[model samples]
Target: MREDVGEVTTSLHRPTTDSSRSKPVRYESFEWPQQQQQPPSNGVPRSAWNRQHRRLSRWHRPYTAVLVFLDLISTLAASEIADVFLEKSKSGFQHKSWLFLQGSALFTFFAYVVLPLGWLLLLWTNGTYDRRYLGLGSEEFKRIVRTSVTVVAAVSLLAFATKTDLSRGTVATVSLCALLFILLCRVTARQVLHLARRRTGHGAHRMVLVGTLPEALEVYTAVTRSPAAGLIPVAIHITDGYAAARGIETPVPVYAGRDVLSLVREVGADTIAVCGSASAEPGELRRLAWQLEGTGVDLVVAPQLTDIAGPRVHIRPIEGLPLLHVEEPTLSGPGWLVKNLLDRVVAGLGLALISPILAVIALGIRLSDPGPVFFRQTRVGHDGRTFRVWKFRTMYVDAEERKATLEELNESDGMLFKMKHDPRIFAFGQKLRATSLDELPQLINVLKGEMSLVGPRPLPADDGDYLGDVRRRLLVRPGITGLWQVSGRSDLSWDEAVRLDLYYVDNWSLTYDLSILWRTIWVVLKRKGAY
Candidate 1:
């Protein structure tokens, strides 16, 4: 059995004797292997792993900062050449060394000095430079790109509105160059780090995996693929009796036993990565915690949650229990204000920009069907209040009657309803839904204050009534587009849908809302998970 008592056992010596005088006397010396024992030391175990991690984190940022600074300086130099070329073409190839010098200096100041500084501030705000992000996924890259673009965009707008006489061509040139160089540099750095990690077989923290074969395999794949995360699975402890076949062909050795602590120490891992059910009793997990209290090792529990972002999960300690608090998603309070304001402003601009297209869709719908182009249905909204949710009619008027016949084919779980390939969709409705054209009229709902630009998808009364204890989805104003729609829409399981809504509810922030909006554009463009 695995042990965490800081004790090791060797074969014990036994005296040979016969109860009766029938057996001949045998003299033998058997020496077992020596067992190493720790000397009496401090009660608290030292964390060599933590020290290494912290030290690496300290050096990571300055390295990236230097790369960013040098890249921007290179971009400024490129912009100078581009500006000189444009000037010569405009002024009969005149040799204006003074003009070139002045333009180059200005570009250097704005792109290299100002823009990088602004990016640094934004990165600080977004936690982009956090040590935890160092060995993570493309998330860090995405954040860097986002922060850089935002800074450049802000500067551009400021230059345009304030008449700063900043050369627009030079700004664009430098911004594009800097963005490309930064992305390339980051990608190269990741590749180098990945190679180094694999070659040395160091940097990765050893892990004792506790789960069934299938779950353990999944965890193993995740850790192996993400080398930068530094999670290395050294041993897997299967709880099932010796009958189940191992699911993964991992280089790491596998052992079956009930002693979790022994397995942890045997594998030389302080971190116990729990993935699935184990042979140990449920209370054993807590008891193991007690055993490792001052061992300076972390117990990392990997829940079955997948594809869920961290911002959505909330931990609330309740009555000495660590209760997970999932908030219902809504667009209200300042979010409501922001969405309402954006709705009016963007809608007005869109109407002015795309009046012809809106006119075309209206005329096409009118021509296709001899009914109202706008379909409004009663949907449960914030605080369980009902509102008329508007959409371009993407179904025949008898779609409700048809739904009753398809109830047996409903694919979704709990109160939600969905079908992969529904028979009730109108001729153009399939195209409309796939491209998210049906959601356009909801901009009117946004304007009417019945909906916001982003929130949980407003559910109809039939589904809402069947919500049982899961109807916390109505806490905030209904949204035109929401976490559900962008995430997987009709394809998501009921639990996942509710979990996402709860995540949005608990972590409501303007930044999150904007992120959702930005993601919505991609979701719509991709048309993934849409029926």
Candidate 2:
């Protein structure tokens, strides 16, 4: 065996869990890699962890604030467009710009003023406004939508009773347009920002891979395949001879059979992504993590089950020890009502607002090729109910018939079938999906009350067989936009999608609804997850 000690340092170290706690995990003298030694036997300094936390948050805080600001603007603009058109238009023919302005101001006042107050109530009632919920998922968007609707309804009633002379055409036009336009702007901004971060390197966090060579390679392949994620893998450190002999050469340097703690220090790595199932002693894992605790580095364990998402895996503390809890997904009761109400409101609004866009898409589809303007498919919805989900036709007439033969090229996870670069899509269809204009027809499903503004995903009935604990998802109506669509859409593993839906089910609130609606803008505009 050849020993290439690039930078070797050794030290005897003690692992401490806390300065004030009772017994800590005691370890004898350990041979750390020849990179760096622990400071004189007392303990490893703890300030390092704090530094990493600050660094990570510093990068994220401004970006999040930008999102919030953009969301506010969307709400304002939508209302203004509606209001301005109404104000300037005559009795029969409403002025579009005046309606837009009126809608923008109304939506703006409603969102920033009325909705914030409701959020305060929600905070007092259900703690929905806690900072922890921000950027978590669709919950925040759900609340925003619901609160805005409430304000709109209240204003509608007041104007009617007070004889305020607000034109129905104008009110409807402005209200709908404001919401749509505002959402569009926010989505556009998010995609731009995410891409900017990926390119600038300011948005991503770096991690070192730790495992057997094979397992490390698996993780490397996965991370590298999606550079848009902003993860920069700086180096690889193998813990065994088996990994070292694998002949895998990475762009970054590799060190073999090095002590984990030493590698963390000298490499200046702030995090470690543990891969594969190697039975390392529990004591050793704890020691390595404890030694690096104050350094701001983190340990992320990649379990063998690659299909599952974070929300599905729950950790519980049992008798002073931690336990992982996996819950069955289900939607029930008030969750259904909240979802239903949102569906009705959003569907009504979408149909009205997108009428022009729908016409445009329909004309384009018709002109591109000879076929019906709309495409209908039998997709399963709430309680296994079958419904015809609609989209502006994006494929040839025989697409469904051709689907069976092309199953071999399916590149999706779980029961969901997808082809990243499917040839079946018509020339114009690709652009439609990328911009999400194709799904506009599903607004009819919303109006028919077969779907919602937001809920668990809708799947093809035959595809239902692939589900495990998936029926819980159907307790509420399906949506044109749902947890899966907003989070990562086609890019997610089936398990990851299920986890998001279940999270929505377990914690269904108006706030969650608002968050999802808001996120839909970015999901559609970024078009990263669209096929």
Question: Tens digit of lDDT per residue, candidate 2, span 336-437?
Answer: 566677677877887888788888888899988898988888888877789988878888888888999999999986777799888788899889989988
Model 2 regions lying over 4 Å from their true place: 1-37, 40-196, 211-230, 236-256, 265-268, 273-282, 293-320, 323-330, 356-371, 395-434, 455-477, 482-516, 526-531
State the C-alpha lDDT per candidate.
0.63, 0.62
Model 2, residue 169: distance off in Å is 32
Clashing pairs in 1: 2-262, 3-262, 239-279
- Give the Å error, residue 467, model 1: 5.7
